[model samples]
Target: MAGRIIQVYGLWVWVAFAFFIFVLFNQSHSPLPHSSGKPSTVKERMMRAEKAWETSVTLRHEMANKHPGYPRIPLFPAQTLEAFGKYPYTIWDFFPPVYTCPHDIQRVGRLGDGGKWVCGMSLYENRPALPASKAGKRTKPGTVIYSFGVNGDSSFEAEMLARVPSAEIFAYDYTVASLGPQIAGPDSSRAYFKQVQLDRMDVLDRTPPFMSLQTLMKNNSHTYIDILKIDIEGAEYYSFDSFMDWCDRENAGEMPIGQIMIELHLTDDENLNFNRLLKWWERLEKFGMRPTWLEVNLLAVTLNPNKADPRCVEYVLVNHKDRKNIMRQES
Candidate 1:
């Protein structure tokens, strides 16, 4: 009887322990956290992760601000603001790395001075003098002044030239294939127009063929150009190269030009583009010219404020000696 009772108690204890273990296992394996039907902890986790990321970004920006030689915020020139206000572009997008100078003032000259103005022809009337009178000849009213790439329409070039009565204009454009009749007609005498390709590189190599500024100077027997305006669809790169080469030759006592007006195109990547621009500026400096005017454009679309177009600004360089003359005149 005692043995049977002990056996029965052992069986009961085993049954109770098994029941307890089963309950504990079920609690441990419950699907409350991961079930699709359960309340979402996932969204809460994601929100927390985003908050952490933003905090990290803020901390990094603060650290960068404290760091030496970090990129500084850029300023705009007064003329640029007046001409093109808050146009969605950042100067950081187009400016080259080494040319990272302040843009808030006239980089080429002091403000409120009668400096040689460059860009859209609004300020040309305020200049101290027009091109000097041609040597030995009495200044004639409305003498022919030939400009390239005017496309048969009167532009700032034509308007500014008109201010000087000694200029009868002849503007040329070869790229506009449809305007041959308008440019080459008998009715085009006061400002004769020609639809001729003025951007060809091969034409520069010819001796007396066509459209060589050197040849034109040779033909006219004139030493200096009064107002040579150039805005030839990024052709300024090669043209300026040639112009510098000519200047070098002139420094060696060969052909030389008087005044030059060129529109410079800069690249978009600040580091790469700035390096390239610095090389060009260094060359200009070697030839004794400095930046007199600069216009930076930030191409932005209405739908996207954060994004900007890459090709966005024009810089104007003039002779440093001329800049000094401007300063003297202003004083």
Candidate 2:
């Protein structure tokens, strides 16, 4: 009887061991918990890559908001965040850039301090070769470039026109009567200039006439801007404030700019407080502008010997929402 009981227990133990082995084998062959059980095709790989990119962008945004650079003295007090009760300060290197370009970038201006760092020369280069039959026919209008603060340098404008002669270039600067000799000679017809200051329409006691971006776009009948370059001294704060209000009121949620290359001047003034700077930057980001490139203005450093941090910084930002439309036209 004891032998019979022992044999029954041994048979049960052997059956349990076989079941465990089967379960382990199935687990080893099963898809990972985080992966879909689909064949890896080109489309699937691309989808996975896109998902990874989105995840990385979200992570970087969170990191930027959560961990700011080592705390420093605030640039402005809290009272200046809003203006005229309607416009508010949008908030910045305390604000790290989170945008990147995957295309081949090149410098588009003079080799010295006047040139701009541009991403993807597709707008100026890589035009589909014109067939022999259509070699002379005028192609569609090239990119539209609006540059503010042509203080006396037109190297950028000249090079752009040389590359794409059909391009429409408009420059504005209240300080200068005309563009530099590069574009101001007999060949200046390729570029247009206006002695206007980029400012709010309501500001009073302004000697030179000023116009907001919205007003200029309307007057010029420009529905889109391929590139908008601004180096308006330190007026960006107020200029952007007015522009943001106009955006909120007129264009719904989209900005009409494709790319922005600006030289931001941070002076030791109450207007450029740290909080205000961050708010201004945040506002631009809210409109889908992402900085793909940034460089400390070496000229600013060389010129301003007293300040530890130079007053000027250069930023090249792409408007993700509107760039595709402009890029499609260029292509």
Q: Runs in model 2 with CA error above 4 Å?
A: 1-92, 127-141, 184-187, 202-207, 327-331
Q: Write the per-residue lDDT of candidate 1 for residues 107-187, one digit (tens) a residue.
A: 221222112234223223344332445663334322334455554344444344444334444455555533223333332
Model 2, poorest ten-residue lDDT window? 83-92
Query: 146-172, model 2: which lDDT tens digit per residue?
Result: 999998988988877767655668899
- Write down the lDDT of every candidate, Cα atoms only: 0.43, 0.70
Candidate with maximal lDDT: 2
- Give each model a TM-score: 0.45, 0.68
Name the regions of candidate 1 deviating beyond 4 angstroms.
1-146, 168-170, 177-212, 251-260, 266-272, 297-306, 322-331
Clash pairs, candidate 1, are 89-298, 96-274, 143-168, 174-196
Candidate 2 lDDT for residue 117: 82
